[model samples]
Target: MFSNTPISANHFLIKQLPQATAFIDKNFKVVFVSDKWVEEFNLSTRDIINEHIQDLVGISSKQWENNILRCFKGKRTENFQENYTSIDRETRWLKWNILPWYNENESVIGAIVQAEDITAQISKEQKLEQVQFILKETNEIGKIGHWKYNQSQDIFSSCPMINNLLEIEEDSKLTLDEYIEFYKIGYNRNTLSMAIFSAMENKQSWNEKLEVLTAKGNQRWVNVSGKPLYCNGKYIGIIGIVQDITDYVIKEHQTKSNEHLLKTLINNIPLHIYIKDTQSKKLLANRSELDHCGISNEADIIGKDDFDIYDKELAQKYRDEDLEVMISQTPMINKELSQENSDGTTNYFLSSKIPLKGPNGETTGLVGITMDISDIKQKEKDLRNLIKVSSEQNKKLLNFAHIISHNLRSHSANFSMLLEFLIEEKEEAERQKIFGMLTDSSNNLMETLHTLNDIVTINSESTTNKKEVYLNKQVHKTLKHLNPLLEENNATVITAIPLGTSLQVIPSYLDNMLIQIISNSIKYKKPNVRPEIKLSLSYVQNYTVLSIEDNGIGLDMKKYGEKLFGMYKTFHEHNDAKGLGLYIVKNQIEAMNGKINAQSQVNVGTTINLYFNEEN
Candidate 1:
């Protein structure tokens, strides 16, 4: 059916061939190329006729060229597949079938080669390999095992990995009943049984996650899936796969538990907690923060910003601070902040803000907590006020003692001079007059000593043995004792002290001080004016202040106001004007942790104010 001529001589006939065919000589030179080869592989017969195959194909793998060599030496067909990147940078595939050609001398001269475009085929084959690899890897990673249960024999055929998945002995195949026992009874076993029955009766497939217990008494979670197998319209068996999911299940449960705990702690605590999105400007505020913002529902506040709830200025300020937090990406700790409330009041807080980070350590947003500090700030203010009052008391106490010493020295000098005069006199009448002068001087010295001792006693007692003392009753007792003196001066004491007036103070000191101050008004009355005193008690700024007004010869306050309470500094001309009375009054009030102030005008009147601290 063929000619005995060399295949190289039939080049003219090869041009009419339908398949892509090329003939190469023993020396690997191209002998012929069919018209189909030129059209299919894009080759030129004239250009490649006498050229070496290496020069035309431009193939670099010398070892891969062995197919051509084998065909050149033998009268046989060689099949090969080749892939390479083309000029357009796409991968091209070719399947080559090379057959040796013979000459009339019965010797192989060249080979006829046929090439087919197989790019799509090779691409599909590669994809299949990749899918297989993925499936195998998934099964291994998930610790999956496959099984088939034959209903006829009530037996299960399991993969090698099933023993590991179920924690059973190696190489041991279990019966269907034994495998069912591995499922934790109650819910887990019942579910599996129902699923199996559903698959058999309703032709349904099941994919469920459930718990299991092994022979070794270890519990685990498993992902199970099965499909029922049927033959001749009758249920035959079931086939399925299983995966151990204990670690994944446990981890998921723990994560949810931790989230619940954090939610409880955040909502229940007193601090205002919040989280904010850096870009969207959305806020997630906890329960305490919601209450602070006067919002009742979480849904109402979610996805909202400060602008939604606060005034424009406050919202802008809040956003600017958020920007600062994002830029710094560090903790902003213990910054004092004040926020205005809906009721026109302001609340203070010690706020701390910190940035939230992503998995790659990039700043994502910010979280903050604010502790209310208004009460602490109020306490601090009260402490400062108390310190100021204590300092003023110490300064006046020093000045008060110095004035008392001066008065003592003046009285002692007068006593020494009078005594010396009495001792030197010799005449009987003169001696008698000197004795009377000595007696007056001794009484004055004794009075000075008693006043000085009272001042010392006032300074020594710091804390009072506090008790409720009735003010009106004490005033009554003093007035009764001074009735004789009041009668001699034709004085009237009009008291506005509430009938049930009461205070917390030392009883004896309050009684003595009240007597001295009340009598002083009577003693210092103007020469022509009747002795009139009005005493009243009322509350002023948490203090019970007693006011004693008298139509007395008041001194010029512009001249003596500064030393009005100075010991031995007398403003009025009176036989009993020692001026120690008011000084001693100041000390007694200080001992009770109270205050006294006197207001006077030129011979008009006097008002003595005694301030007793109370829950007025």
Candidate 2:
């Protein structure tokens, strides 16, 4: 230090600097240190002056030592930033400058070393670098970019991410007009233009989602956000960020379209479909379901429980079923539900319900589908009735066969016996008696044959071979033929049949039936009471009904109702009662696909109704 007296004088000046600095002599020993240098390095209790520079601050690098050695040869050396560690093992950043000091003879005497502690500044720079790295990574991964607009200069600048998104060259400078051209032509361009204008005029901030046409002629969706830049009450420019949102936009559009399609499909289906949440609240209902409930719009039913729409008891039943299905997480498929209406009719439904589950397989709600099966149920009932009727007809036909065989055998035996007797007679009187008996037997056989023939004809008649017969004309014709019998019995016939009242039937069969019915009214009249018969026509559901009321010897219905229409069944003991008229009439009516029922009281009257199918 004595070799450079001038340097010694300036050492005090060097120590007065505000920076944490140090001065060293050519021998690599620290000669002076500033107050800030002691505080910065935590060397207040240590005497570093005159200490070897390497001892105080370890400079282990060879290049750093060479630079310090060069200062002794009248050369200057500097390092703006270098790493260092103090003797206490404290790491720091330093700015170093080493220069030669001259004596009075203008020759190099020793070196001066100056150093500044730059650890805090270096730390701030490192932190800033790390932030920039993170931001760049985020922008690339998100397909996003930042942009700036200079309004006065009409300049637009964007980051590298924007260039990649647009599929254009990197670092391209664009004019305001050129920048806007990247937006799509119709809605996107117009919107961006207005946004820019508003931002420039009113200094407003805006964010918009818009479409862009890339340089490669591809379409993309993007979201742009902008904030007006202001400086000291003066509007200057705009800063904004843009993000590529093509994937998100496409997915959103597809989702909406699918929702619309599903809604349309469910609405058009004939079955009633509905969705309910765990709370049994209606979440969705299709058109059929809405129609069933007499609702015009599905929105009116949303978030409403069954209790809000249906009868209290019915709603409770539905809710209970729904809860059971959801709680069990099971599906009820093709379950037949029958409801008894107030009118004593039962309505049927084919219903299905499935549990709706969450992502973790927990029950969330249920979806139900129901179809009205009342028509099908009615058809089943009709089929069962037809089967029963067919079975009964089969049984009656069997009985008829047995009756025919028995009657034919009896007639044949009587004929053989009478002929045998006639051949063995030896007297004329006996021959005459045999002849009379033969005649009577022949007549009886003929009558039985005719009756059998009639039965066979009625059963074998073709149901399709039917013609429209006016009831009034037919009744009149039958009465005209029976006028003699009617006069003898003093029987009166009254008719209230309409002129055009008609029934589809076999004409010959209908004529025979009318004759039999009118004759019975006359023959079975009470011994002292003149017979009175009334004929009328009326219409009932799906049937044209003809009713005949007779004031005659009526039988007790409770005793004979079941056998009234049976073959060879007779309630009266008249000599003319062959027990076949009502049976034949019933068969003929059935052959025409009509029905007959009778109501009667002993010694009072009888009313017989014939139902003819209107459709037939």
Candidate 2 lDDT by residue in tens digits, 1-616: 3555565677677777787666666677776778777787777887898888676656677866887678678787766578887777778888876667666886775665566878999999999999998888888778889889988877789888787878899978777788789999998999998998898888889999999899999998999988898779777799879999899999999999999998889999889999999998989999999987779988998999889987899889888889889999989899899877768988799989999999999998999999989998899999999999999888888889888888888888888998998899999999999889888888988999999998888888988889988888889888999999999888889999978888888888888778877787777778899899999988988888888889988879899999998877887777877789989989898888888899988888888888877576
Candidate no. 2 TM-score: 0.61
Please give the lDDT score at residue 257 for candidate 2: 94
**Candidate 1 per-residue C-alpha lDDT over 14-94 given as tens digits, one digit per residue, 9 for 90 to 100:** 878877777777777776777887776556544877788666665555534677677667846457788855434557787
Roughly what TM-score does model 1 have, to 2 decimal places? Answer: 0.64
Instruction: TM-score each candidate.
Output: 0.64, 0.61
Give per-residue lDDT, candidate 1, residue 356: 90
Among these predicted structures, which one has the highest TM-score?
1
Q: What is the C-alpha lDDT of each candidate?
A: 0.80, 0.84
- Report per-prediction Cα RMSD to one decimal: 8.0, 9.2
